[model samples]
Target chain A: MNHFFEDSVFFGVTLSFLSYGLGVLLKKKLKLGILNPLLVSIVITVIVLVVTDMDYEIYYNGAKYISYLLTPATVCLAIPLYEQFEILKKNVAAILAGILSGVLTSLSCILAMVLIFNMNHKQYVSLLPKSITTAIGMGVSEELGGYVAITTAIIIITGVFGNVIGEFVLYIFRIKEPVAKGIALGTASHAIGTAKAMELGEIEGALASLSIILSGIITVGFAPVFAQIH
Target chain B: MKYLRQFGIILFISFLGEIANYAIPLPIPASIYGIIILFLCLELKILPLSSVKETGKFLIEIMPVMFIPAAAGVLNVWGIIKPSVIEYIAVMVISTIAVMAVSGLVTQLVIRLTGHSGHQ
Candidate 1:
């Protein structure tokens, strides 16, 4: 099997698509929030690689092509933000305040962990951008001398956690407003959380997407400053 | 043909973003630049929504799948992460919940105080 596909550029890409497609199917059939397609796909891919004794570097060679699409996809997020311009205009103040508060909260929490847990500077900075999307978070982590792989993993876990329990948390906190719910998910969990927000409502999706960009920028500005703490 | 064009536009903007990312001194990523540039183009009507809508939706819909490769990269670093995994989990869970609660509540509070119900 390895010899047959060893030289193919599409090998890893094919595996990713197949696993992700199966994940989507499973989610549709199971109706479980915890059955997140991304999470499922990662598990499946990892299992396949481990079972096949394939080197991660080999898998990433082809898989990197799919990753290449991430920037363009991120650019496309502007469409949703543009489409919901009216609501955005009306709630500009609330939107800014929500995202700002979330960014600050995330930073402060990381700072507190540094103090309480006695975490090293690398670990602290790695966790600093955990709340943002993977693309931006990885950049921030690398810039701050944090482990990029650790940051990516942390970001994914943060997003999956938010996607799974975002609604429950909102309900528990009595957060009934659509804009607020969107802000909560996006600010706290990035695009994956926005996926859940999109399922909730159109306004929610737009607001969530907007928060992702805002929170990400704000985190980039502050991450370096926070890195100086330890 | 339409999707190809739309994808081309997005790719072109992303390339510009990469350039800006190199030119700028900030820590911001190229993707953010791409997002800002594309957004400005839309807001200014230099690029119509129809030009990128379908392809944009397709990209967004598959956004989750894009992270798989990077997320899977985590497997390579388990040795470094294993010792402190508990602390990492602690910080992530606590901070994530705190952020969600604070952001949601603040947005709601601001909306109510600003004399808007939720949406018009």
Candidate 2:
């Protein structure tokens, strides 16, 4: 076990890569709707834990090295947004207006529920960053004394549900433009939703990327003010 | 030249994000500061198209890898989450559905208000 402890970081990175690889394999083989890489990585990681009985701390010790990859990965999100600059320029005001309102509305509804339900401060803070992706959500949770675990679950669920049902709602409502359809899912669910948006098409993916960037800014900037109000 | 320009944009946004982390007292972390700065650059056209497109592409390509940290945290709290596994799953499933539904409604409302509903 001590030998395993020394190799935890190596193990963690191996698991991370394996999760990604397995996800790709599963997607190719199964054509499963909800079997996205992130979800797959999560399932695989949990199974590994249960079988090894490695405990969370030891596993984290192994995985912390790979954890640093998140920072660079985050720094890289600017790529797609940069690639889609032309489309964004064509419809700047409309996209901005749509994403902004959408983000604000999300915060309002979540906060309103928090207050109405009388969730304590931690739960409220945890849920505040719920609309964003997991990294930012954790950051938001940490800053506000919210439970990061709870926030992680919220972010994942937000992404999965948005990806699963976003298209149906858009079609039912007859949203034809790829850009509009993309922005709606991205704004609501962040990156996981953005993955689904990308699958829909380039235009939708672009809009979703724009939404991810905009919603992240809007949600982070506006959340504190709203938190103070309550 | 293209890579240089992209790196420059990344560095500039990173700087802005760092500054935000220092300046803002909010509990929310500040990498989002980079996101805000990126938004402003796009809005202002200061970063320029040639500067970041390549870099942005590279970044999103590896987006899924970024979740490693958050998922790792699950390792830390497994004990707490384990005993209450059913409760935790319920919270994850129920709250997720509720939040997504609410967010969709908001996006739809915004689309309608902007008179762009018909455009879609």
Candidate 3:
């Protein structure tokens, strides 16, 4: 009876794309700002994995290729950064300042959470890279002796929120400029936020992409200092 | 052919990044090297933007597709993370909003002071 599904080799990869297709369909059909396809796909995939009694490791074996693609995707962001080089040259100072503020805010929040919640060493460290892109966040988290799986979960949770409410926050704050919007999205949400930024504007996409990298670098630096404190 | 060439440029840059990963003694990942080198390449005219712009855009546009598997992998560690689920969710939400508000406002203020706040 279960022979058909016993292989589970291609199932993971095939399911990922199929769920992504469903996510796209749902997003188009619902037209909700918060309807992130990645989030949707994960939810659906998780349910399917649970229902099918599939071990996550088996699923991961095939899905890891998609995960590997993140490296090149991170590399691809350079194109947008280059496209908006002029604005970058002009607003370098402001951009740096904004990144600093964002980095500080993220760190402080994590610090407070760790202190308040009394989280364990690994838990706190995993959450440290919660706001950056997955590839960099995974590296930083692992360097801090945290689990990559936990770090990714925290990161996606952060990104999903930022991708959804990021624009609403800007609208409320009256942050009309592309640079400001992009910085906030990228700094707070990483790649998913950058995707939202891309939808917002070219300038936003460029700045958000830049912000993703900068915040990542900042988190890498911050992780060491954070380790010393703990 | 155009897409292939553009993708080739990105892959080639990523390859260099792998080398820089060993050459440089930073915790920074190879992908970061890829980004930095590519930026320098585009800026220095060593690699023309027109060559890779479309392909780069396409890859980045669909980046969410790549993140799905990682996010789903959360299932593997959910048992360990389940205890602090509430705390984790709270921290993520609060921190995201705080970071966004602080950075966005600070950037807007700084750019405004520079007298160039026309959304650019």
lDDT of 3 by residue, A66-116 (tens): 777777878888888888888888898889999989998998889888889
Worst 10 residues of 1 chain A by lDDT: A1-10
Clashing pairs in 3: none
lDDT of 3: 0.84
Best prediction by TM-score:
1
Q: Model 2: which docking level applies?
A: acceptable
* Weakest ten-residue segment in model 3 chain A by summed lDDT: A1-10
lDDT of 3 by residue, B2-117 (tens): 99998888888888999998898877778888989999999999988898888888888777777777777777778978989998988898899999999999998999999765
Candidate 2 regions exceeding 4 Å error are: A1-5, A89-97, A108-122, A133-145, A160-176, A220-230, B1-16, B23-30, B35-55, B78-120
lDDT tens digits by residue: candidate 2, A23-94: 889889998757776777777887877787766667777677665544444555555555566766666656
| Fnat of every candidate, listed in order | 0.83, 0.22, 0.82
**Candidate 1 vs candidate 3, TM-score winner:** 1
What tens-digit string does per-residue lDDT give for candidate 2 at B1-70? 8788776767667776777778887543445567557756765877665667676666666566556545
Candidate 3 or 2, higher DockQ: 3
| lDDT per residue as tens, model 1, A144-212 | 999998998899889978987898899999999998999999999998898778778878888898898
Weakest lDDT window of 10 consecutive positions for candidate 2 chain B: B92-101
| Decoy 1 TM-score against native | 0.92
